[model samples]
Target: MGIALKIVLALVSVILTISILLQSSNSAGMSGSIGGGAEQLFGKRKSQGYDAILSKVSTVTAVLFIVLSLILVAIE
Candidate 1:
């Protein structure tokens, strides 16, 4: 059980990293850092197509990674 969990965790970690890397950057530079929050807050930026899918994938994988980590620790 422990070994299986470890393998799954490894896979999830890889997938999380890939999904994050595959997504397009929303900000350009220092200017974006300052105004990006306002744009997102006002719903000016919207995710579509591949970006949307990747965003959801990253979110779910991140949550799963956390849950799996906790479970693995508790079991040990």
Candidate 2:
């Protein structure tokens, strides 16, 4: 059980990294970095198609990674 969980955790980590890398950058430079949060929060910017899918994938994988890490720690 522990070995299986470790394998799954490794896969999830790889997937999370890939999904993050595949997504397009939302911010431009210094200005965009400062204002990008508002744009995202207010729905001024939207993700479509590939970006949307990757965003969701990354989110889920990140959560899964954290949960798996905690579980592994607890098991140990």
Candidate 3:
């Protein structure tokens, strides 16, 4: 049981890492400073398609990672 739990934890860690990497960076920095005006004129930003799905997946994976870590600690 312990070994199986450890394997599941490892898989979840990998998934969490990949999902985080797949998500887009929120910081625009210099580019945002220049393009902020144009974006405002265009209106509110919308997240559609793959980005939205990836974002949700990242969130869920992150939560799973945390929960699994706690479970692993308890088992040990």
Native-to-model Cα distance after best TM-score fit, residue 66 in candidate 2, in Å: 0.7
Give all TM-scores, in the order shown: 0.81, 0.79, 0.77
lDDT ranking, best first: 1, 2, 3
- Please write out the lDDT profile of model 3 over residues 2-66, one tens digit for every residue: 89888887898898788889878765898887878677678766689877888888788788888
Give the best candidate by TM-score.
1
Model number with the top lDDT: 1
Please list the C-alpha lDDT of all candidates, in the order they appear.
Answer: 0.93, 0.90, 0.82
Compose the digit string of candidate 1's lDDT tens values, residues 1-76.
Answer: 9999999999999999999999998776998878677786787756678999999999999999999999999999
TM-score of candidate 3 to 2 decimals: 0.77
Off by over 4 Å in 2: 30-43
Evaluated against the true structure, the overall lDDT of model 3 is 0.82
**Better by TM-score, candidate 3 or 2:** 2
The total of clashing pairs for model 3 equals: 0
Report the alpha-carbon TM-score of model 1 versus the true structure: 0.81
